[model samples]
Target: MAGGRIVVGVDGSAPSLKALKWAAGQAALTGDSLETVISWEYPASWATLMPGVPPEFDPERLAKQILKQAVDQALTPEVAATVTRTVVGGNAAQALIDQAKGASLLVVGDRGYSGFKAAVLGSVSSHVAQHAPCPVVVVRGETGDDEDA
Candidate 1:
C-alpha cells in the first residue's frame, strides 16, 4: 500500500521504541506516513484506592510526553517532523485497533513477559495482533540495537 498510513503503538518502553524504529523504517521504505499512538487510562480502583489524585497529575499529558519522546528518540529530526502523534484515552489494544481502521499496517512491541505473568496479564501486542483491522507487526528483542532483520 504505497503512501498509506502506518500506525504504531508506543508506550516509552524499550520494546515500544524498537517498534517505533521499525515502523519508521517501514514507512521510509514504503513511502507511507507514520503515525505514532499512545493511550492512557486511570486505574479501575483509583477513586477508591487513592481518593485524592494530585491536581496536576494528568495521565493524558504524560502519555503525550512519552509519545513525543519515543518518536524523537526512535527517528531522525527530519523523519520525526513528518510523523503524526496521537494520544488517546482507553485500553491500549483497543485504542490501536480503532486507530488502525484503514491503516496499511499496525505495529506494536512484544514486551517479552514470560510464563505466569504473560498468561495472567496477557499483552497488548497479543491482543492487537488478533483484533486489529489491519496487518500487525509485533517487534521483539533489545531496544537500542540498530541492526535490521
Candidate 2:
C-alpha cells in the first residue's frame, strides 16, 4: 500500500520462484519495494474442533513459517535484503486481491503446484488477473524443450 510498492504472490513452486526473481529485478529497476505475500488456510478439522487438544493454535505463526521457508528458497541474499514478507490466511486469490488495493503492481506465477490442467493457467493466477486492483503480471514457468515445441 505504500508508495512504489509491488506485491507478489509466492508459493515455493518453480513458477513462483521465477516470478519472485522477475519481481526482484523489476523492483530494482523501478526503485519499488517488493512485498511478498504468502497466503494459507488451515484444514476444516483444525478450524472447527481440536477434540482433546487445546484450540489455541496460532495459524498466523504457521503461515509465517511457511512464508519464510518459501522466501528463503526463492530469494538470493541480494534480493532478500530489499523485500518485505507478509503472511496471511484465506484463499490465495482473495488474500492477494485484498493486498493489491494500493499496490503499484501485482505479480504472480502463471502456474503453481495446484495440479490444475496443463491447458489452463493456475486458478490463483487467473483469479488475481481478473480481480486485482493494480496491474497484474503472470510470469510463466520455464518448460522443457519437448513441451515448448
Candidate 3:
C-alpha cells in the first residue's frame, strides 16, 4: 500500500473527468482509497462585479453536485463504490493539497473550466504541481487548441 489514499481534483472540466478516471483506476489497481474532491470559493472580485448575485444560489452546493457528477461519469459503478467524495470551500489547489497530505498520489487536470486563453497550465494545476506533498499527475484534455494557445 502506498501511504494513505489517492486524491483527485474535479471541476467539471473534461480534463478533470479524465483525471478522476485515471485516479479511480489507479486506486482500484493499487488498493488505495480514492478521495474525490471539489473546492469552491466566492471570489472577492465576483462580489464587486456582480453585486446582485443571489445568496440562495450556493456555489458550494453546485460544486458538490459537479463533483458527484464527475465521479459518476469518470468511474464505473464498481470503481465509484470505492470512492469517497468531498466538497470544501477554499482555493482549488489548496483544498487538494490539504487533503493529499499523506496520499500516495495527487491528480488534477492540466487546466480547469477557466475561459482564460493565455496560459498552458491553469493556476490551480500549477500550484498543486509545485506544492503537492506527493506525486502529481496533470491530465491533459484532448482539446487540440492547447498548443495554439
lDDT of 1 by residue, 1-149 (tens): 58799999998877888889999999999999999999998877767766788878998999899888888888999999999999999988899999999999999888732223546343888899999999999988554775652
lDDT, each prediction? 0.86, 0.81, 0.84
Higher-ranked by TM-score: 1 or 3: 3
Off-target runs (Cα >4 Å) in candidate 1 are 48-52, 112-122, 143-149
Off-target runs (Cα >4 Å) in candidate 2 are 1-3, 44-59, 115-121, 146-149
Scored against the true structure, residue 79 in model 1 reaches a CA lDDT of 96
Candidate 3 residue spans exceeding 4 A from truth: 115-121, 143-149
Candidate 2 lands at a TM-score of 0.78
Across 41-72, the per-residue lDDT of candidate 3 in tens digits comes to 87768878668888788988899889888878
Model 2 error, position 122 (Å): 0.5
TM-score of 1: 0.86
Instruction: Judge candidate 3 at residue 30 and give its lDDT.
Output: 85
In the predicted model 3, the residue pairs found to clash are none
Candidate 2 local lDDT, 1-149, one digit each (tens): 33588999987777887888788888888888999998887656763454555567776776687667777777787778668998878888899999988889999998875434465558899999999999999998766753531
| Model 2, CA-based lDDT | 0.81
Error of 3 at 98 (Å): 0.7
The 10 consecutive residues of candidate 1 with the worst lDDT sum are 112-121
Give all TM-scores, in the order shown: 0.86, 0.78, 0.86
